[model samples]
Target: MVLYKTPNLKTILLNVFQDGILPYDIEDVLSLLVQKHYLMNKEQFLNYYKNDINQFWRDVASLGFKRDEKKATAESNDINDLKEYPEDNDNDFNIDDFFDSDEFKKRSDAEDIDNDAFKRNVSLIKDYQGINNSNERKNEKLNDICKINQRLVEKIAGKYEKMVRGTCLNIDDLIAFGNHGLLKAIDKFVPDMGYQFSTYATWWIRQSITRGIADESRVIRLPVHLHEKIMKIKNEERQYENEFGAIDASELCKNINMSDDEYWRFKSIAYQFDQITHLETIVGTEGDTELQDLLPITITVGSKSVPPDYMLTPEELFEKKELHDELENTLECLTSREAEVIKLRFAINKPDTMTLEEVGEIFHVTRERIRQIEAKALRKLRHPSKSKKLKDFIKG
Candidate 1:
């Protein structure tokens, strides 16, 4: 018998979430790398994680997640649970504090300070004996600037992936850019000039990544050179008609001296149109309404409370009002706990109010017991005939 060792996407996702990087969509590229390299286990992952905690945070938690393990698996068949994202592990911030996590204000405050003496304090510089090119030497030496803060980069990347799509860049890339940026800063760095290496290097690393991303992004977008040519072709066609009159397709082809097939290809290239975006740009930004949008408007009005008597009309509203009244009468069959759970969960709509843990805490039961009850409740809700909707909703 053979025992195979390989980490799958699902396992990596669970492990990442368990490891305290916010439970969100895993980076597909990182998943591919993990699978290809056979470095899915904990020890190997620590090497990727420990050095670049901020970067790891961004890569793992890029998805704005609402569901915990129980909620995710309540609907999914293959997975039993989505591992819960850890509580604020470092106690650096509270779960309720959203803007504080990124710490933009503290940084902005630093810019207001003017301390020339404090600025030139380069005592942290490491000693390097032998090196050749000034740029290369500076690059190697620049690693000292953010040596400790690189760990913060790892954390952000690992935990904040859902928030920043560009975090597709992984740990090695972060370090490489940091090192490279530091080198550039070194070449530009002057003890005589008076500036802190740390601040400058931060800017350098950001520049390196931004430039790299622009280059990388340009690859995914149609090349600018191609777009330029396409635009020129279009302009020429416009000019062709403006100066030479409304020439038919055959006449334009005759002017261009291309055969029918080649002209068609050229025309196709020059006249390419972006469907949805083109309409949005042309008509002041409105496009086809998605099913997701239509309900939001009506739901918002209902949620804010359109008065029941003020809102209901005779025709369709009467039928809906009657049906809703009937449904509530049926809901009267459920117990208070069941009714509250059902209404809060589905009827009134709270996206993420009570976690299973929180619910268990309230009822003085184990989380596992809560799970069993929740599953039972959900199963009952799925087939309302099996149990009343409100009753089954609580069971879940």
Candidate 2:
């Protein structure tokens, strides 16, 4: 880790921005750098950086870091000697504070940083003694920059680690993403632009970490860019549901500027990320049953809810068997022809009930003759002794 003690702001900025002596040169460098690397235009670049370039001067002034341009011009025309950056004269303002963890805001500075290693790590950033036009020197400087800001990446990653709780990501993964953002920040850093590097780097660090979470939070990952829109739609749905008690798909599509087909496709993909509960997950007040207990073994179409055969309790199974046996015994009281006719008409132990004409064709009789046989069989079964047992199974 690159440890740095708080140094004079001028020395730090000068060492970092030595390649570009003028602010205008730094601007051009940044413009071409972002365009070549990120393919971002001016507006997109500002949005990505989370600040307007025009506001840099104002921000520096508010932070008490801005110096008078006239005084600097009069002091020296040479960039090497110009007082373009501020002297750290105020006790209240420290560049290191920019990298402080906002999570520990409630604690005092002494309480927040209790680590002895961190205390020992504090040292002034190494000067640009070896930095020059040489490739080795440039690479050395780049390593120095990355090392010095390593803690900043870790701190920023700490904040994001919470955002991705319950996700597949751990702190190490988040820190990796934060390091990528730190590299991007180093590439884009223009120290002469009047903002602390940490302040600027925070945006890139957060963007990279969040983009990583968005891309990898699910079993089936989505594009990093679409995550923003997906979050917007979800937030809108929550708000709409809270206000209206329900959501209208059409209204929600209009609100998010999505077509019905696109919204449904996204919804389907989103479902894939929903939490998976194990069949063994406990349920009920006493926690005596598993999740699978509540699920049906078989689903029948156009029928009232009834337990599948495998799900039936011992008593229910016994009752069903008894009723079926009783019905079979009652059918035996009829003549063979009458029993067969009744069985065919009522669909007993059959897939479908037969019409009078169908039964007549089967028995080689007319429909009227088959009907008389069915009526006679019903009259016999309607006798109190024969009907009494079957009546117990029917509800009023």
Candidate 3:
């Protein structure tokens, strides 16, 4: 788990690297989002769903989920047999935008541009993007529709995740939003029309998420005034810092005409509302017993230790089942208090730790007693019996 206590816009953007996982408790806040009653259910009324979502319907319908697809068509046999569509009329659709940019090229190698094939795909998107009210018939070829839409879904997935105002989200949630938006566009697309389906679908995706949020949130906590203040003042200040180098929060306090405490409160609350969950600390596991000793004296732990399996490999992955078993087994061998010290040392510890002299002050132990416990734990790790269990604990 990637824990975080705070997140800036950059941190939020980085979260999208996961594609659609909108993490943090933002999903919790989504319930607070208000869905404006503009053209209520217009999207559903218009039959706008592209590939994946459409297939979701078909599969369900086929399994006698709903009666709609039962008499629908022979073409809708399965996901692959769904639909395909050719390129739309006369427009130069560019896949270059979908391709990683030059900045990405500078960091990595340039992607292969199958110019001919790309142009055809572009034409396809433009063709479908143009589709208007007249073209959407209830009975359409399932395959042509599904294939064109699936590719389009893949393409739009990037933008829907990227274009949102705030960057905070889990990788999986962002990807889900993008995929949902892309697929939504497919079902509602009118290729003969002039406007792009992407423009339309972005709204749909946002709407789905927003509607979901509104339905679930107990109270709408994001007041419009605060949102405006955050968007205007906070975003600009950060941008100014990026452009001019850096500014202290003190400078920001004077500029914003608020006390440091008040300013930070506003900033923190605003960022929280924006759902910018990032930082290793905030996302990381809590009550991590292994991490207890590495931390400082001021820290505290209440959460359970994070399982080893959650850590990514080649960095510090321990065999979770085995490591957990080791810890459980090792605990049996130690005194209740020894276990307490070990947990306190790593999990409950905080930044800028006290020296052994200071820790002795709190525990009423001579520095020697503390030293013995620390050394004993270290010595235990040298033995193969306790090494794996000792290793399973995380450090903040």
lDDT of 2 by residue, 272-309 (tens): 34332334589889988765445432212122123234
- When 1 and 3 are scored with lDDT, the better candidate is 1
Please state every model's RMSD to the true fold in angstroms.
Answer: 28.1, 19.3, 23.3
Query: In candidate 1, what are the lDDT values of residues 1-396, reduced to their tens digit?
Result: 000123343454455444433332224334544655535544455465564433444333343212222212111111111112222221222112212223212232123333442243254342332244686665555454445345433432233223124334555654555455555544443332233444444444444433343233232443434443333344456666577554344555566565545554544433332121232233224655432212211111212222233233344467666556655665565666665555544444344457667777877888787677666555655565744543533423
Clash tally, candidates in order: 36, 4, 69
Give the higher-lDDT candidate: 2 or 3.
Answer: 2
Query: Who wins the TM-score comparison?
Result: 2
Off by over 4 Å in 2: 1-155, 158-163, 273-396
What TM-score would each prediction reach against the true structure? 0.23, 0.37, 0.27
Model 1 lDDT-worst window of ten: 73-82
Q: What shift in Å separates residue 65 of candidate 1 from its native position after superposition?
A: 55
Over 4 Å off, model 3: 1-147, 150-156, 159-168, 187-234, 244-265, 271-396
**Could you say which candidate leads in lDDT?**
2
lDDT winner between candidates 1 and 2: 2
**Candidate 1 structure, TM-score to reference:** 0.23
